[model samples]
Target: MAAVRFADGDWAEDAEFAAYGAATPALRALDAETAHDVAVAALALGLGPRRRRRDGEALRVEALGTTFSNPIGLAAGFDKDARAFEALLRVGFGFVEIGSVTPKPQPGNPKPRAFRLREHGAVINRYGFNSQGHESARTRLARRRDAVAAEGDDATAEPRGVLGVNLGKNKLTPEDNAADDYVLGVENIGEFGDYIVVNISSPNTPGLRNLQGRKHLSGLLRKVLDARDKNPGTAKTPVLVKIAPDLTDAALRDIASVVKSEKVDGVIVSNTTIARPDAIKAHAHGDEAGGLSGKPLMEPSTKVLHDLYKLTGGKITLVGCGGIASGEDAYAKIRAGASLVQLYTAFAFEGPPLIPRIKRELEECLARDGFKSVQDAIGAAHRK
Candidate 1:
């Protein structure tokens, strides 16, 4: 087989493209948060690897009433405060999910909150939904909305790429009132986003995962969906709830039930895990007090995603995330029943050049499997 090359040359072998591949090592040497900020700034300046955007029917998938250029999306956390989503779109992601934004700005947990398990290609982050709050994020998103609105003569032109706002509760907010924060979030930012995500799965947030309980989840989704509907001028935004990868099958069943009953539009099958693998246990930062993301999470997260598809009988829209390191991984998620897939840890580790590579590999995977469209492959694993 010929050696696959991402850019004009094999980036792994080319010194000219080394800067992109080197971002991981350079980032690992700094405080993880600081390194993240630097990357975000670079993205804003469009200093990362660049590529021509690709669009066509083959790469398109319809879900949430939107046509995604590809099934791969830039997951939440990278653009946590709604900064740099536009730049990300230009990098060729089919969609970009920003924020785990709260009602007010939060400092999050103390420093050393994020760590890289380089040997394992994994990461741990206990950032506690640190955000610039609803108003700050909404302001930036509104500006984006306005800028796009003014871009051409067609004031009502279709959105170029899908945007999802991941909404979370403030750290100090009592679990009893968690629904209020999400309700306010949908009303305030829902209009600006093509979709909204109800995030209640981060291990970093105390008591937040409790919202995943049947009683709490049902109530929360009801209130949040109601808020999404109340937004004026804009159509009802597709609402999704992200769950932790550590959840039990019983709990997943409950979530599928609540999501169906409440009419939630989609589900991001799994978030980072609070668990660690025995294989990576000896690595430094292995026992860090945060959610673990990347390669080690692949099996568990995909299992959850697959089970969620079966539990929901493939009726629920699903977005598979966590441990996606290649196009094959993304394709696996699709076959497991994900209408879409997202990546963040892999993006941080692999850089912008990784995006096009994954897309190309995904298309190849579909063709090899004799699938005419990516959408046709969704849930094929569960056909038996």
Candidate 2:
């Protein structure tokens, strides 16, 4: 009896030790949206361990004609309001993107639109680009900029980590006038952003994906670029289009042609996906009517990134996103031709702690691969 008791005690200790060693539990606590808010608060308050000891090394990457202290950035949909800029930057991200903010504020889809599939390390969201509108986002960003500037620590302080504003048309906007709505967003919020992303790929928004058709996409890009030109002293806000991963080879080629002809700055290789594969077969919410992110998205999105890289011939910058949860994932995107990478679903599964972890892993990966810097790794896979 004593021997059995001792064995059980030993097993318990091992379990406890393993739990302490793993970083998954804390990351899985908050639900998708709530976890995002909590992370924003933590970053704003500087609550987490400043230096993630586990992160292997540091990497600096440049993209869209701007310099980033590191290659990891917060993808859009994390801070839709632009309210947590300071807090997110404080968390040590290389860049922070806010909004898919529309010209008018709207409550996204009905509740319970976000779901978690823990076993797959995935989330499905049909947020429909719910936003507080450009006016509100612009107002908050303007105030944040003033506060940062007032601190008077311009040199040593972070440049608020390259603010990128993602723009999308309002739900009610017709396809014919989508360009007008996009222009409204560009004209109103262009000055506050380091760059502007034209989002036409969100699966939740009604008929939004239709804008990706070549004719419509070309017109929208032209108008948005023209709007940027009209804004004087507003250093040409590099315009990039965010695309959907479900597009076929022909569709991708058409969009790539539009990007080149319009001279757009870059492409966020993908938004989330509506397709579910065998990998997520056992998940209950697999059929949910929204885009699936996290591990389920990695392969499909990376394939899209590779495709875009080839189609564009590496001319335009590519920001790979979807299902990236670690340094290895980010490294894959970078080597596949992404100039930079962003994350959202991984944060849902790994928590804020994952940021520095990924950065560290990426650095180690660079060293292991004999690349001196992140730029050296870009398209390494495709080059072969």
Worst 10 residues of 2 by lDDT: 1-10
Residue 243 lDDT (model 2)? 95
lDDT of 1 by residue, 1-384 (tens): 122235554443244335566655777677778989998987666555534444546678999988897888998999998888887886678899999999999988988798877678789899988899999998889888889777866645434778898999998889999999998888778788888899999999999999999979998888887777766734567889999988877888898889888888899978899887897678778887889999999889999999999888899899999899998999999999999999988888778778877988998998998998898999999876
What are the TM-scores, per candidate, against the unseen true structure? Answer: 0.92, 0.88
Location of the lowest summed lDDT over 10 successive residues in candidate 1? 1-10
For every candidate, C-alpha RMSD to the true structure in Å: 4.6, 7.5
Give per-candidate clash totals.
0, 3
How displaced is residue 373 in candidate 1, in Å? Answer: 1.3
Which residue pairs clash in candidate 2?
A: 44-87, 56-360, 294-323
Q: Local distance difference test, per candidate? A: 0.84, 0.81
